[model samples]
Target: MVVIEQEPEEPTRPSSPAAEEQAAAAAGGEAVRPSSSAAPEEAAAAAASGEASRAAEEEEEAFEDALTDEQLREKARSQANDAKAEGNKLFGAGQYEEALSQYEMALQIAAELESSEDIRAACHSNRAVCFLKLGKHDETIKECTKALELNPTYLKALLRRAEAHEKLEHYDEAIADMKKAIEVDPSNQQATRSLFRLEPLAAEKREKMKEEMIAKLKDLGNSVLGRFGMSVDNFKAVKDPNTGSYSVQFQK
Candidate 1:
């Protein structure tokens, strides 16, 4: 079992468009201009061409107005670290929804600031765990997938995704993932034990299904004997592969 650390709650709401502009301004950049109030089709066409140059120019002006790229990147990293810390706090308090929000913020900042694979993997895995707590199996799977794609050797991502797959009744996929995780981290007792449990259950299920099929075939053969007014001992049974059925022949 992956020991997921809880994240903290988000300290504030998401930054609005206005806030994003303000942040840019504070950094010496201008805010992005709003699109014109024309019909969407017309606006899209305009935005597609030079007509949208005005917005681009406004954004450029903001960029020129802000601090250096290095400074902006440092600021983004700092903000992201703050969000990550908050997420950890929320997770500790069992506020999964709030924790997930903060993790998302941290991930967005990481993407923009550092392109740091490690931080991105952590945030994705954290969000996946939060989704698991919220009982959102599909979303958990998605987030875990993202984390794994970022770092294939990420043990927590593999284990958590396997759990989510089990919740979805995709047992084979779950087993496959767990096996990979075990290969990566042989010291993980939880992964090893989970594999142990799944292997036996899978074998047992197959055995049970085989037994059921055999019992069904026996009943059908007996019914055919009764219809022929003969006991099973009085006849020999042969299967016709073409029709997939047994034919009884009178004994010599």
Candidate 2:
């Protein structure tokens, strides 16, 4: 035989003074009078205030419980859209900081809602534009990255991030973003033009970096070879054109 477990009963609590007074009146006994009328009035007011607060809390809980998930999402979307529209207006007016704040508000409102990724991505991209307008290239890149993380195919985010990278002289990163943007929208002239412009800059930067690295290596080699009564210049490196390999030779 299986025995069922039972919940323990709650302990009885003592009644309040007002409850006792009402009980006494119901029992045909005179209620004990308070020292001052103000005391009872204050106590009654406090009780009423507490009851109203509890009632309000219950009503709010009930209302929230009554709403379907779709209804809540729709409400959040509407709010986010409103904030985003305000941001656009501010951006048009050249109030970049204010526009950023509005986009932030939109992001906050939509962040927790299910299926709100598009709005969140849009807000992040808008914030990136604001940062770009304010000359904050790093922040623009960061916000655009967040937008792209939400929606990798977001053309505006990709373009904005590419622009930010270009501002920071990050030619390779700018070229990569432009390439991705072109992949997303092949017909976009802006991305196509940006990719064309950035490729040359990236190539030049790569060459410059290669030269700098080789110069540093030469300096280090000279430092080590000088102790042996020799210099790096005394050695020559010859490249085999067909094999694409280099061989070092010792010279006087």
lDDT of each: 0.82, 0.87
Ten-residue segment with the worst summed lDDT in candidate 2?
26-35
Q: Write the per-residue lDDT of candidate 2 for residues 1-252, one digit (tens) a residue.
A: 224688954534438987766656645856445556677889899789888888998998888877866687788889999999999999999999999899999999988887889999999999999999889999999999999999999999999999999999999899899889889988999999888888889888977886697679789999999899788898877778999556778889
Where in model 2 is the C-alpha error above 4 Å? 1-65, 68-72, 237-249
lDDT of 1 by residue, 1-252 (tens): 124576944444337986765556645745445556678998788657655677788788888767577787888888888998899899999999999999999998899765678888889999999999999999999999999999998999999999988887667788898999989988899898888877776666666776697667667767887886765566566778998566667774
TM-score of 1: 0.56
Give me the candidate number with maximum TM-score. Answer: 2
Off by over 4 Å in 1: 1-67, 205-252
TM-score, each model? 0.56, 0.69
**What's the true lDDT of residue 153 in model 2?**
97
